[model samples]
Target: MQPNEIAEVLNRPLSQELLARDLTRLAYVATDGTPRTVPIAFVWNGTEIVMCTTTNAPKLPALRHNPAVALTIDTEVHPPKILLIRGRAELDLVQGIPDEYLQMNGSYEMTPEQRVVWEAEVRSLYDSMVRIVVTPTWAKLIDFETTLPSAVEELVKQRAERQGA
Candidate 1:
């Protein structure tokens, strides 16, 4: 999709709401050519989706080899609202903890004291991290109220033609 079109899809209110969600299912290809999907915390910084992981994460090597990826953020309720994004991952190896990692994980419910302990543990555990950044090249928002999957939309059209006949 064109950049403008992708932006249009992402700018919708439903899409914005989904973007604020704490986790996204990141789908990518493993080095062995197998597809993998893992739920990971992420932050959407208007233009990019940022996810952080330890330097030794198994996915890092796979991502380095093949950067193409897709992300799905959705509601668990019936008539689910889903935001789909396709992008290329750009890996940034940074020393120390990245602020985006903290921000991405900030939405979890935690008491102030618990949060302090968690931060301390995280700081002690990782000396460096890899930032997986993706600038969306395509996007789609599907809210059953206003939009349906392409196949479903086609079925609806066929049903209308049959009824009209």
Candidate 2:
């Protein structure tokens, strides 16, 4: 999709709401030529989707080999609202904790004391991290209201034709 078209899809109010969600299913091609999808915490920074991982993460090698990836963020309710994004992952190694990591995981329900301890544990566990940044090249939002899966949309059109016949 064109950059402006992707931006237009992502700029919708429903898309913005989906972007605020904390977890996204990241899909990528593993080194073994198989597909892999994992649920990971992420933060959407208006223009990009940022996910942090350990320096020695297993997915790192696969991503290094093939940066192309897809992400899905959606609601769990019936007639789910979904935001789909495709992009190339750019890995940036950073020293110390990244603020984005903290912000991404902050949505979890936690007491102040729990939060402090969690931060301490995280700080002790990792000296550095890799930030996987993806600036979307394509995007789609499916609310089942204003938009829908392509197959479903086709089915709706076929039904309309049949009814009109």
Candidate 3:
């Protein structure tokens, strides 16, 4: 999709709500050829979704093998609002701790003292970190009340035609 078209979808109210969500499920193909999805902390940087992981993370190998990925951010309530995105991963490896990682984890329930301890422990444990960057190529917002997946929209149209016939 063109960038502006994607921007339109991302600008929608439902999409805005999903983007505000703290956790997103990242789906990618594993090296072993299996599909894997993991819940990850993410920050939407207007034009891209940025995520961070340990340098030696197991998923790193898989991501290296295949950069294509999908992400889903949604809520648990009824008439859920979902934002689905497709993108290619761009990895940036960095030494020492990263500010983005700390920012991503900040939304979780943690006291100021706990957060201080957590940051210190993370810095001591990881020699380096990897930032996974993805510039969304496609975006869809599915709100049962306001929108549906494109495929579902087509199916609904087809069913309506059959009924009319």
TM-score of each: 0.97, 0.97, 0.93
Predicted model with the maximum lDDT: 2
**Tens digits of per-residue lDDT for model 2 on 1-165?**
999999999999999999999999999999999999999999999899999999999999999999999999999999899999999999999999899999998999999999999999999998999999999999999999889899999999999999995
Candidate 3's residue-wise lDDT over 1-165, tens digit each? 999999999988778778877999999999989999999998887888999998888889999899999999988988777889999999999898667787888888999999999998998898889999999999988887778877888999999999995
Q: How far out, in Å, is residue 128 in model 1?
A: 0.3
Could you give the C-alpha RMSD of every candidate to the true structure, in order shown? 0.9, 0.9, 1.5
Writing each residue's lDDT as its tens digit, candidate 1 over 51-122 gives 999999999999999999999999999989999999999999989999999998889999999999999999
How does residue 109 of candidate 2 score in lDDT?
Answer: 92
**Residue 12's C-alpha lDDT in candidate 2?**
92
- Full-model lDDT for every candidate: 0.95, 0.96, 0.89
Total backbone clashes of model 2? 0
Model 1 TM-score relative to the real fold: 0.97
Candidate 2 residue pairs that clash: none
